[model samples]
Target: MKILITGGAGFIGSNFIHYWMKKYSQDEIVNLDKLTYAGNLSNLRIVENLPNYHFIKGDITDKKLLEKLFKKENFDLIVHFAAESHVDRSITDPDIFLKTNILGTHNLLCMALKNRTRFHHVSTDEVFGSLKKNDPAFNEKTPYDPRSPYSASKAASDHLVRAYFHTYELPITISNCSNNYGPFHFPEKLFPLFITNLLENKKIPLYGDGEAVRDWLYVEDHCRAIDTIIKKGKIGETYCIGGNSEKSNKEVTYKILALLDKNEKMIEFVKDRPGHDQRYAIDFSKIKNELGWEPSVSFEDGIKKTIDWFSTNKAWWKSIKNGKYKEYYDKQYANH
Candidate 1:
């Protein structure tokens, strides 16, 4: 099978590329990434020279580029992952999210319909909005109540995908996954930021009392879940994939501290971003019962593997930390 993976250089997308290539060496994979702040080609260094793996530097929002590439590649499947995904960035700048997530998805859908290619959308559980501490976990049927611009854009893209499925009979599957953490992760999100910060002996920023809860799905588990969905899942279905391991910010911070043999003094509590979701959890039973898939990595094991990766991959993330990302990091977490 020949597949096109949008945003394939980014964290989860790059991980998926590695996972797919390793599992199905016979299949051909093409990566389309815009090389944005979060997208790093270094993640795919191992497979860059492979015969079946190819990379293209482009944007999904460019309609002409999509047309030309779709015509040239004639791909059998397209996994949509490109987006301005950071909620804090979206809060400060929403135009790009609207254009990329909503409009870019529409562009891809048009091309997919034209080319008769099966499409799968990678989404987030944040689209279902925040959950109360006692609220039941989010499922496929949950109504979207996006609070942040990033989640709202993702919600819009989700609606668009379903619209194409129902109206144009587009063959598509969507998976809303929980928070992902693993190797090659850019040092901006929770796990990477904390781990790298500890490595630098810098204080890890703990947002708003360090109590917001999240289900931390290891990236490899997420990649496997997506593979299951594309290969065996029912078209037009949305699956919720999660780690089944829930942790609060404080709890997770303490875990990192313990792993690195550091104390709580390394943590710096800062003002939380607006619309910070109190909790997010997924009910992944649908995929589990139907597809026989569930997260295999325990949080205990996953965190250790992640820490080891960051420790050994200092050069990979060090370059990113030394670039423009450092400036953005400072401004984003200025309120302490």
Candidate 2:
């Protein structure tokens, strides 16, 4: 199978490329990334020279580029992952999120339908908005109530995917997954940011009394779940994939501190970002019962491995932290 992965240089996309290549030796993989601030080429350094793996630096918002690539590759499958995914960034600047997440997805769907390629739209549980502490976990049937600009854009993209499925009879599967953490994760997200911060003995920024809840899925487990959906999932269905391990932001921060043998005093409580979801949980039983898939890595184990990766790979992340990655954001998100 020949597969094209958009946002392949970002955290999950890069991890998925590695996972796909390793699991299916016969499959060919092409990576399309815009090399945004969060998308790092170094994430896929291991497979950079692989015979079946190809990388293209292009934005999904560019319809002409999509046309050219789709025509050239005639890919069998396209995994859509490109987006302005960070909520904080989205809050400060929403137009980029709208263009990249909504319009870019529309472009991909149009090209995929034209080429007769199966599409898998990668999304986030944030589209369901926040859950009260007692609220039932979100399932496939949950109505989207996006709060942040980021989730709103993702919600729009998800709706577009279903629209194409129902109206055009396009072959597509959507997965709304929980927070993911693992290797090659850019340092902006909580996991990488906290881990790298502790490595440098910098204070950890604990947002909103650290009580916002999140379901944490390891990156590898999420990748495996995507593969399962591609192979066995029914078209036009949405799957909720999660780690089933829920933790408050504070709890997670302390766990990282413990893993690194650091002190809790290092936490510096900060004002919470607007529209910070109080809680998020996923009912992944659909994927579990149907696909026989569940997260295999325990939070303890997965986090430990992640900490070790950041600890050892200082140079890789050091380059990102050395004002190089910040320069991109400075140019775009100049105000915030």
- The backbone clash count of each candidate, in order, is 0, 0
In model 2, the clashing pairs are: none
What is the Cα-based lDDT of residue 277 in candidate 2? 92
Model 2: per-residue Cα lDDT over 1-336, one tens digit each: 899899999989999998988889889999999988888988888999989999999999999998898777888999998999999889878999999999999999999899878999999999998999999999999998999999999999999999999999999999999999999988878999889988998887778689999999889999999999999999999999999899999899989988889998998787778878999999999999998999999998999889888989999888898867666534533433
lDDT (10s digit) by residue, model 1, range 169-215 = 99999999999999998899989999999999999988889999999
User: Each model's C-alpha lDDT?
Assistant: 0.95, 0.91
Candidate 2 has its poorest 10 consecutive residues by lDDT at: 327-336
**Model 2: residues >4 Å from true position, as ranges?**
326-336
Total clashes in model 2, counting residue pairs 3 or more apart in sequence or in different chains: 0
Best by lDDT: 1
What TM-score does model 2 achieve against the real structure?
0.96
lDDT of 2 at 121: 97
* Model 1 ranges with Cα > 4 A deviation: none
RMSD (Å) per prediction: 0.7, 2.1
